[model samples]
Target: MIVVLIGYMASGKSTLGRILAKKLNYDFLDLDDYIEEKEQLLVSDIFKSKGEIYFRKVETLYLKMLLENNTKLVLSLGGGTPCYSDNMNFIRNTVKAKSIYLKASIPTLVSRLKTEKSKRPLIAHLETDELLTEFIGKHLFERSQFYNLSEVTITTDNKTEEAIIEELVLKLF
Candidate 1:
């Protein structure tokens, strides 16, 4: 099975996915990291040098390649991956693929993304917590529709990674 983890920035898709993959003994692949490795450019650099449209197109290509070619895999996608290129539908329709939305409240997301903004390309330019919170609020609202299409939704606010993983495993099996 291909387990695809989707959510907004700092919602723990990649972090939880690594542990989930370890526990399930599945091959773990982070789409952004995969893109960096394959394209030889940092995700942020891709955005700056080529633009978001180019990045999204490449992201969709690699998403299709990974889902089509792998099984027993845990795939963690970028925050905007589902919102672009009909990627969520592709993930949902893929054979043996299960999409899990790691849902986090806006406050929880803002708190997490505050510390993580430097690493994330999208919110890095927001200079204040208020701006960050506003961005997250609006971005989450826009992307929630795509994210809600997931086969499973796991709320992650104030939850330990182990607890989230436990819930994920139960729901997945």
Candidate 2:
């Protein structure tokens, strides 16, 4: 009963994963947080200190480690997790894991990410809403090839958190 939530940034993977894990009484693991704990560095710090290639490798390694060692868990992946290093392929083929994509429109993402930009390394340099919007649109477009492979795709636009969770529970159960 391992559930993996995937999406672009600010798509509610972490927020929804926490509540879903609680409702199901499963262990909740956010891979970025897990990596921070394991490496003793924030994800952004890892990217800054070691570079994205290194971060991606370590992320892939840690992702596989978590999937192999855990069960009855709800996992929230980093926004870029699926887009990197055959990770999507591994997630899709893993036994006992159900992958769900939290789909959000570029506008929805732009709105959410605008205020949270400083906390996100990838878009931290983006200074304008226009720039952020463009980046999200392009990024999501490229990532959709991978994200669309999810076992379930839930559109999060205009949906309440509880409503989204209810839909997820219905689809999952």
Encode model 1's per-residue lDDT on 1-173: one tens digit a residue.
99999999889998999999999999999999999999999988998999989999999999999999999999999989999999999999997999999999999998887887877767889999899988989989999999999999999998999999999999999
Off by over 4 Å in 2: none
The RMSD (Cα, Å) of candidate 2 is 0.8
Checking candidate 2 for backbone clashes, the offending pairs are: none
Provide the lDDT at 168 for model 2: 95
Instruction: State the TM-score for model 1.
Output: 0.97
**Candidate 2 local lDDT, 35-116, one digit each (tens):** 9999999988898899999989999999898888889899999988999999999999898899999999999999999998
Candidate 1 collision pairs: none
lDDT of 2 at 158: 100
CA lDDT of each prediction against the hidden true structure? 0.94, 0.94
Clashes of 2: 0
Worst 10 residues of 2 by lDDT: 115-124
Count steric clashes of candidate 1: 0
lDDT of 2 at 19: 95
